[model samples]
Target chain A: MNKWTKLDNAAIVFPSLAKAKNSTIYRVSAVLKETVLPVRLQQALDITVKRYPMMTMRIHKGLFWRYMEYDDEPLRVKREDDYPCHPLQDRMTMEALLKVFYYQRRISVEVFHAITDGSGAMEFLKTLVYEYLRLLGKAVEPEDKIRTASEDIHPEELEDSFHRYYTPGRPPKIRNTKAYQITGTYFEPYGNNVTQGVVSASALRQIAKKQGATLTEFLLALLMYTIYRQSSQDRKDQRPIKVSVPVNLRQMFPSKTLRNFFAVALFEISSQQEQSLFKILCAIKEQSVKNYSKKVLQEAIVRNINLEKIKIARFIPLPIKDIIVKNRYFLYNDKLRTCTMTNLGRVDLPKTMTPYVDRMEVVFYPTANNPLNCGLCTVNDNMTISFSRTIRENRIIGEYFRYLSQEYGLEVKIYSNEWGISD
Target chain B: MNGGFQINHCIHCQVTVEASLQECPLCGKKLTNTRLSVPRSYPAYALHNKSSYYFQLFWKTLVPLMFIGAFLIPSLITLLTGEGDLWLNRETLGIASAWVLVRYTFLSRMHMGKKFLLQIMNISLALFIFDHVGEARGWSVNYVIPFMLICSTLAMMYIVYKRKRLWSDYAVYVMTLIFLGFLPSFLYLIRVTSLLWPSAAAAGFAIVSLIAVYFFLDKNFRSYFNRRLHF
Candidate 1:
């Protein structure tokens, strides 16, 4: 019999909210120095799935909740044909939450948010690349951090970190004040227009250093400014443009579990007062510093856990809970944030394998209501800023890079899938 | 330059190659070096195919038209013929309700269990409305609802028993079904209808099933309750 495990607290909300438009899926890709070999890639994937058993599991419905169970079905790799971060309909495929796709020199792993977060996905991607290289008879080292397929699966990798780190206390309640919302005509055929801008990490770092802010803070400030400029300026009452930044909790708490272990912190820039780039960067720096602090993050963890711990919540049937949670997430999380900016930070690979890989990109799926989202990751001093938008208008994206080129004097190389939606 | 050809370097992989190729020969990544002021890897323009949008548009336009046609044709016949009998209008309403139920069952994106519950609720409501409109018969209350409650309870019990690994998961659903099965008996006790046999049978079946699960399958029952009721 296959082993079954209950979903962690953070994963409880994704299954209920996933739909065609809002899949809650994300992609992490590694571009190699050579074309991807399908046979070798599949062989590597078969081995990698055994190491990350949780990623290969299928979601099973329960009375009051949903759980994950091991699936004996084989994990297969296919060529990239569809758009990135498409919905994973269990009935239509092998029932795995994670899928491996390859195209030309790029190998991508797309995962439904219910299984794991970006940190977990990155680990899996690195291991897969390592194994693939090894299979091709290339000299690759494990580097101690990369969990290889040959090693036995550790109990720590499967631990539910939320339950492990949860402390008994009254979590602080957050007010549900409405934030600014971006509205636009969605692209036809329910597709996401992916536009990636590549730039030198050193250049961005230099600018950020001059401004006395980190790269993430600098990017968040730029995003807020872009949204502010895009919105109607005639209105007297303008809500603050809030960006939801997902913070990986592994940095704060000591846990090696490859599950959904992350929390979101909202960074708001008020439109009521006209602000310069420096002022916006300061706002982002202040909010991020306070929110990502140990005490504040602990409270956020407690708040999320306490929600599931309520006696009444446990008794409520899954169907009813699904509707309630889905609506609540739509009203609170989606409406309260103008857009989400998730930075995977710098990606480190094995020294031996670094020469074989080119660059990496992360793409987040757009929600049904919210059309635009941003994902950033840096590899080998190359920063890739990827924008996945479902809207027809590309003005915000155009203005964002424009500001970078004009103000910061950084030349950006742009590539796009060209989704062909016009304003 | 060899044969009047220039060379470009891939900034990412550090591989140098010919400039004629759009991407590097070693890595499939697009070349960074270009003669143009601004370099772009892919094409600058794309074609918009709105077929999928039009497909959704077609369905959106068709459903209302079908609904109007369903109501309009029958009412028009009655109006033109000047018939005194309004039974045809009542029959049309029944058909419309049934159609609506069928559409809901097919169109809804709910889970199987939720869909089953919705089916039970919709069927019961439709039968009750039919009973009141046509001769005020008590078949819907005394037989159909009780029968549906019993079948649903039994189906749920079988599913819970078969999926042993998920028995604890379905404990609450099975318990709720058991309680719902007895509601028909409560209606009978209040003297709302002349019939009592269906209610008695459903309630007895529910009670016996619960007893069987707790007594004969004691071990499974205990484990399920332990996991489900764990604080």
Candidate 2:
């Protein structure tokens, strides 16, 4: 129940991706030094999880609004022995784990954006690895560490579970995003398989700057353009390509819990015209950041969180809540635009656990119902872009990475559950 | 709603654009400031600007029907051992068949959700009766039977259309009737069948049709598909 109180942190950003409904869980795997966890890292995770237990909370009721607070429950960790990694066949070598279970060599954690954004999850992962390394007596320093400080908890902050983090207002009106690509529909496979690829963070940023775009703008543009190119080639008609981007509501609203705190915004580009890389990047950046002002985001936060609180307090039986949540899937399916590209910008770790820790990799596997899965994770100066799909579209993924390298001058190193080029 | 106004500068290219313009409009950098006194509006009734629906009917009907078939086939098998009425059988099969035809015949014609629902209902009635008659005689309304009816009715529906009548508009109303009529059948199918084929098929149909309709009907699907598919 106190999970809502954890949203008070400035770094808790989660993006909801309805792209793949059945494969909703996203996982980030890190190999920890087999020693005991550093006290600081362990404490940080304990604090982070306890503060936002909603992240670990499951839907006890309601279909679309399926959020429940589980405070007294202990964090469930699965041993690698219980859940082994199942690798896939093909260029995208993905390994799917059943769920998050920690064992001797590796630990895998599954997270849903309804709880937190990519950035927020990366923050947890960095701290976890840092602490794990420190426990083994490894000296570490984050090359891209922005700032260092002691426990800088804002004292006056009350443990109000529903405090607004962003400016307040109404949810932005939903827009009917027209699909611009033509492709057959397919479902995500049931097994848990994941593929990870990493690029130097500084290298990506430098590419973006060189192209006169921000890192996100450049990345999104590369993806949109690539998908557009691949999907359009086999048909006579050309539709606009849409890329769904998850927006972190925490920065725009004021909730401190680790529940579903995100919204989706779409970036569209037409293949009919001579596509301009710079222009497309600019357009995506505009749509992603500008469509909803801070006030608008704030209003949505207050309205959504308040509605949940009211529903819970009204005692609308659990069965009724379940029905409501199920129906919501249909509503969300239509209202949300297509595809997903989640960016978990930069991660931070404690001072004591830096040296032994290398970089990190993050992959997002949307619920099985989604069309495509995209996730970006950064640690130190490296970023890994991972994508998963129930149906295979190697061409789409291939074209996407190719465009990233060709257009932005950023060399993309490819990796998969099947094939990967090691650095 | 910050007075619907604000100032913004593109993070890159230093391009300045008024809040009214979505992109930089110059260097094309996305502007963070979207607030403005006057909200930017598309052409009044942007929906009106949609292209005429022609081949869109083929896509719409084909998409949804394919899914209905995927589900109906498996569910029919399960229903053989389970308990259900002839009316349910005919109704579901009839609806499914009619839906494919109706989609081919009407959904492209109509743009309204309510109207489409109505069209689905119309087709379900006939399909219901036809399916039950066959079921009561112990003949399953699977594979060839439903497919034949749907394809025939759809082709016939178009035949009835006068040269002046647009295929898209008429298909809309037809689709509505079929959807409304077959909805119950679909539900029954879901209940009696654990196989997710119908759900998958229906979802697949919607998704494929969604893209097809966008390009074929609204965006001139064939042209768009050809242009995009080629390169």
RMSD of each: 6.8, 21.9
DockQ, per model, reads 0.12, 0.01
List candidate 1 segments past 4 Å from native. A90-94, A232-237, A420-423, B1-53, B56-61, B72-231
Evaluate candidate 2 and give its CAPRI docking class based on DockQ. incorrect
lDDT of 2 by residue, B9-91 (tens): 44443322335544443233345655645332111112211221223434665666666676676567668867554345555
Q: Report model 2's interface C-alpha RMSD after superposition on the true interface residues.
A: 25.7
TM match of model 2 to true structure: 0.51
Best by DockQ: 1
